[model samples]
Target: MLTPEEWAIVALSLRVSGVAMAVTLPVAFGLAYLLSRGRFPGRSLVDAVVHLPLVLPPVVTGWLLLLAFGRNGPVGGWLEAAFGVSVIFRWTGAAIAAGIMALPLMVRAIRLSIDAVDRRLEGAARTLGAGPWRTFATITLPLCLPGVLAGLVLGFARSIGEFGATITFVSNIPGETRTLPIAIYSALQIPGNDDAVWRLAGLSVALSLAALVVSEWLARRGQDDRAGHVL
Candidate 1:
């Protein structure tokens, strides 16, 4: 019973969230690994910086992003001049906003998994002539796969639900930046648009719930798998 426009909005939301998660996954893993294992100076500072968006107002985050990545901003200007790329007011910008908003959750989940890994096992692998990179690839990453996947799901859910940051960065342009949350907000502004609001809101709830359920299932399955492996 959804209209074509509604379906389009849903599709756009999925695309933005999916792309955001995909783009953030590797970066999140790297940061998680660093935070969980590295002992470099300024580590606390780095961690705080990484988690800043979580505590900062969404509008503030969005405005900061605008300052950093808007056409006139240094990074954005460089990108535009050197690569002819412009993310401002585009779907790409929306993806960036979603990714930033979801990063802390992703990093935290992955970091916890990394911290739970057995350092002794890594040492054993090293004793067997496995290099750090090799051991990480063969042991650490596999052990933490479940957490990484859970993080991705959680991040995807966050991305889909993103509103304030996305709206500020991308302006809710239809067929571009108007995700499900934005669509719902749009519907709410007009009179007698209850049906549209309800439909979009329902879809949003379903998607978020589905993501959380999957994340939980993945975490539980991971625990079971680790237990069986130990046995």
Candidate 2:
């Protein structure tokens, strides 16, 4: 039985992870499409930049985010001054941190999916008088859906599990930025809190498995959809 506080932690984590997924999906999809299909200048550079967060230490990435989005940081300052919106040490900050941390996984999954798409199908659609956008929507997009599903699920899982970047960027404030991992850590720091830790760990495991199961289902459904389309 999760205490109210524990439930709150779970709720906050879900909110943050959901926001992270929603915000990153379009951007990740765009990047995946560009890297997989479009040939342009600085392509390699863009790829490296997109995957930099994956290679960098979580702390380093978080620190960079802080420097770029902190209250006094340039972008953060401008947002606050213009729209009066603040992300520093706020729930939005957690979302941003989670988004950046999960982006590489999302982009990688989506990119691979896009890469696996058969260009012949796209070409055939174009030959049938389909424009670029029309062909992509009818052929390429549908074919790459499994990968998109995989990326979205992976991103959601990563966001839920994110600790280092989120904590560093937003600090663990109760009912605000304290997610499951943060809650578990807090329990460990307290004496005779092993039960709480175990429960939280169990929840994490369950959440991960749920995400994977959902992803698998979607991937299979996508395969069926594509098969029916082929028929």
Candidate 3:
């Protein structure tokens, strides 16, 4: 049984991870589609930028985010002036950090699925009088749904475990920016908090494992479905 405080932490973590997924999903899909199908100028550059966070140290990513989205940063300053909204040291900022960290994973998974789709099927649909948007909605998206779902699960898991970037972006303010990973770190810093640390750590591991298992299962199912479609 978790203490009330621990439960609150868990709930906040879920909310942040869920919001991050919601915010990232459409952008991830759009990038995946563009990368898989479009041949625009700077395509490689865009792809590299999309995956930059994956290669950069999390702290570096966080630092860049702070520089870009902090109140004094250009984008952040404009947003504040225009909308009167601020994310600094808030849960929203933490969600942004988590979403960014998870974006590459989501985009890569969805792009792989999109690439596996047969072009001929799309062409056939177009020939049968379907417009591009209709063909994609009816043929392409359905075939790649499993991968999208898998990506969502994988991204959510990544968001749940996000630490370095989140801490850097939002700091570990309880009831706000402190998520599972941050909570674990906080527990570790306190003397004689071994029991709390163990409990939180165990919960985090279990959640991550479950998400990974589901993601793997979804990916395999997608592959099997594609194989059957081919046969």
lDDT of each structure?
A: 0.92, 0.90, 0.95
lDDT of 2 by residue, 1-231 (tens): 999888999999999999989999999999999999889999999999999989898988989999988779999989989999989889999999999999999999899888877788888898899999999898888789887998899889989999998888889899999999989998999999999999999999999999889987876776665566454
Candidate 2 accuracy as lDDT: 0.90
Write the number of the candidate with greater TM-score, choosing between 2 and 3: 3
lDDT of 1 by residue, 1-231 (tens): 799999999999999998999899999999999999999999999999999989999999999889989889998999999999989889999999999999999999999888877788889999999999999999999988999999999999999999999898879798989999999999999999999999999999899999999999988977876776463
Candidate 3: pairs in clash? none
Write down the worst ten-residue block by lDDT for model 2: 222-231
Judged by whole-model lDDT over C-alpha atoms, candidate 1 comes out at 0.92
The regions of model 2 sitting more than 4 angstroms off are 216-231
Q: Candidates ranked by lDDT, best first? A: 3, 1, 2
Model 1, stretches more than 4 Å misplaced?
228-231
Q: Give per-model TM-scores.
A: 0.96, 0.93, 0.98
Top-lDDT candidate index? 3
- Model 3: how far residue 228 lies from native, Å: 2.0
By lDDT, the better pick of 1 and 3 is 3
Which candidate order results from sorting by TM-score in descending order?
3, 1, 2
TM-score of 2: 0.93
Best by TM-score: 3
Report the C-alpha lDDT of model 3 over 1-231, residue by residue, as the tens digit: 799999999999999999999999999999999999999999999999999989999999999889988999987898899999988899999999999999999999999999999888999999999999999999999999999999999999999999999998899899999999999999999999999999999999999999999999999999988997665
